[model samples]
Target chain A: MKLGVSLYSFAGDLQTGALTVDDALRYCAALGCEGVELIGEQHIPNWPNTKISDLDHINDLCKELGLEIFCFSYYMNALSHYDRRATMEEHLEMVRLGAATASYLGTRIMRPAFYGVPVENMIEMIKAGLPIAEKYEIIWGVELHAPFPPVYYIDALEKINSPWFRLIPDFSCWQTAGAAGHFQANDVETLRPLLKWTVHCHGKGHVFDEHGEEPNTPYKDLMNILKEYGYEGAVVAESEGWITNYKPTLDVVKTHFKLLEKYGR
Target chain B: MSVELRIPTGGSYALTEQFRELGERVAFPDLNLHKVEMDGMKGYEFKLRNPWYTEFPVSCAEDMEVGINGYAVQKGKIFFVIRDQAVPFKYAKNLYELQWGLGEVAQVRMLDGQLQAVVKEANDVEIKFLLRTAFEGYHLPNNRIEYEFKRNMGVI
Candidate 1:
């Protein structure tokens, strides 16, 4: 499996202006990442309306650094309309934009979080977005994050049985300890059944012990499971330690890369 | 120099403590509020962080109020700036077209001439705003999360 880092991992530094999008990409290269993921809304300037020149600049920079743009992640804030939920057309427009951006970045996979939207609506949105996904040659990975089990979306996945619509299982689902005290661990076994539908994965890391192991996530077991399932997609390291632990983002992400190296094979 | 409280309707104290720790880490030790002249008006500007884990639209900002040396600058006087475009807090509700990128510092400017009195070499600054999480099913009363950043900062 190829190891990668998401620009989202550098969120704290990015928010504080310690690093630019170009600097973050170079940092990932310095960390020996074979691939990298970009969050459109976060990394792309004037997103959903970002200038083609800026997109071309980022694409050229990635090529210069020898880092593969593996995945593009974006959010669908369906409830951002204030008094009402965003209409299906609004969500579809976002999908089109996301797909176009991902296509321009030369990434085949896109992960979207349908925040505040119901499961049924999320399924419909994904279904509606499949044509755009196909047009852009992108695979839409519905992130299987915590507070929701892999099995919970099995029905939805089956409904949208197109090749373009798949899953991006975040390792947070298996977190057993650490800063994620509020999120109960989802049965790791449940993920085994969903591996067939996963096109990308989020190697979510919070606090890591002295041994470069995350006490919160069972990476060894998870790696073994993925290996057993013959999954060979990119495991994008997403450092979230800064969220609650206030740890340095670069340090956490570096350690997370090490953890991925140890078990992400 | 920092104090933060989460008025969660029914969340765990442990989680609240975690968030408090988070607030402390992300909080700027110095208010970093600076004096600037914009549109021929003397004003105060400061960098604001997107406190959420993910990016949110500028429209998500609601009921914003800024305090400088105990003086409160309400919504009408505050503007959230992104990519050099400034939108007033009161009008940001319908401007979901603009987003606050994660780790990207957006400027907050208060142009009300009254702010001139509170601008000093070093002042206590506090900014409190309601952020709409906009998650459909997950309810936080008023569909908003409240955040406050208070610090004793030196003017640059």
Candidate 2:
């Protein structure tokens, strides 16, 4: 199980310049993250206001630190009634540009979502988005985010229907303001069948402590599943730092690293 | 300590008025829903649902940047159908009402929308009313709104 982190957890500060790319890389390296997921919006340019040159320094900095980008996060709802067809086309093109940048930076995954479509339309959207994915040789994965419905792993894979299309499993995405029952009742075992399609993992952990510093992820269970299936890909910890703070979330990743090292097969 | 409003999109002006009335009835008189005019994209209409609800829409714009506490309502000003159900599941009466209790559950599009969530538990009416009052009194900036109406209420 490879480890990584979605820089989104720190995006607010990063956007304000309080957290630099160096700060994030050091944090990831310190936490033992093998890679980092770049939030394309915070760093990408030209959807009208992109400062393309701003990321030049960032790309150079990543090379110096030996850090790798696991995925280019492009989480958008392509299926909205709000925009005209041109809007959708524009959104997809922006993702293509993002994929090209990710490729240049050495990552192969870019996540996009067709927001607002009926569950039945998931397959069509995934299939429709394929050419764009192929255009960049980027594996476009749809995330099982909290706001979206509880999409089953198998059904999700079936709907996506392509090697170019896949799942970016956020282990903790199932956790919400709702109780642990929602997570406990999930069919994690069923995911074994879809492991091959999982390109990236949102390695988010949530502890039940009121202080918000506890590590409550079922790492052993997750690792056991991954190991049993021999899954090898970037499992980037999407930080709960927004819910907790930076240090605590970083500490949890460190703790997770220790756990993965100890119990990993 | 940041607060936001989520509205559903694609509904008619009647539904939009109802949503606004609901907010004003609970006293967010200053609440205004604006149309987002971004470059190279279609414009969508949306309105404010509830500002007190913690979960707002995450807007991934054409620029590939996604921001929380914001949403892009796809069709019209109203996109979701609003209903009040007698929740069978337990929840807090207000944001302050339940210090540790899980709130009530309202049966939703059992199988509809982006989140396959059967039910999105928001604060109970009492809590929502109270929170709306408290925040309105505190003078908060209306951060974001989601489109809640998707079609003509009479049709759905």
lDDT of each: 0.76, 0.45
For residues A1-265, what per-residue lDDT tens digits would candidate 1 score against the true structure? Answer: 8889988888767766677888889889998999999987678886766899999999999999999999998777677776677888888888888888898899999886675134676677777778988998999888877656556567777877888988888887788733474346666787798988988889988778889988878889888898888888888898876666565677888888888888876
lDDT of 2 by residue, B93-131 (tens): 212211110111112111113221211222111111112
Chain B TM-score (each prediction, in order): 0.80, 0.17
In candidate 2 chain B, where is summed lDDT lowest over 10 consecutive residues? Answer: B59-68
True-vs-predicted CA distance for residue A200, candidate 2, Å: 1.0
Judged by TM-score, which candidate is best? 1
Question: How would you class the docking of model 1?
Answer: acceptable
Candidate 1, backbone clash total: 5
**Model 1: fraction of the reference interface contacts it also forms:** 0.51
What is the per-residue lDDT of model 1 for residues B69-124, given as tens digits with 9 covering 90 to 100? Answer: 88887557788887798878788888777777665567788898887777788888
The pairs that clash in candidate 1 are A14-B103, A15-B103, A116-B135, A116-B136, B31-B153
lDDT of 2 at B12: 31
Candidate 2 reaches a DockQ of: 0.03
Fold similarity of candidate 1's chain A to the true chain A, as a TM-score: 0.95
RMSD of each: 5.4, 16.7
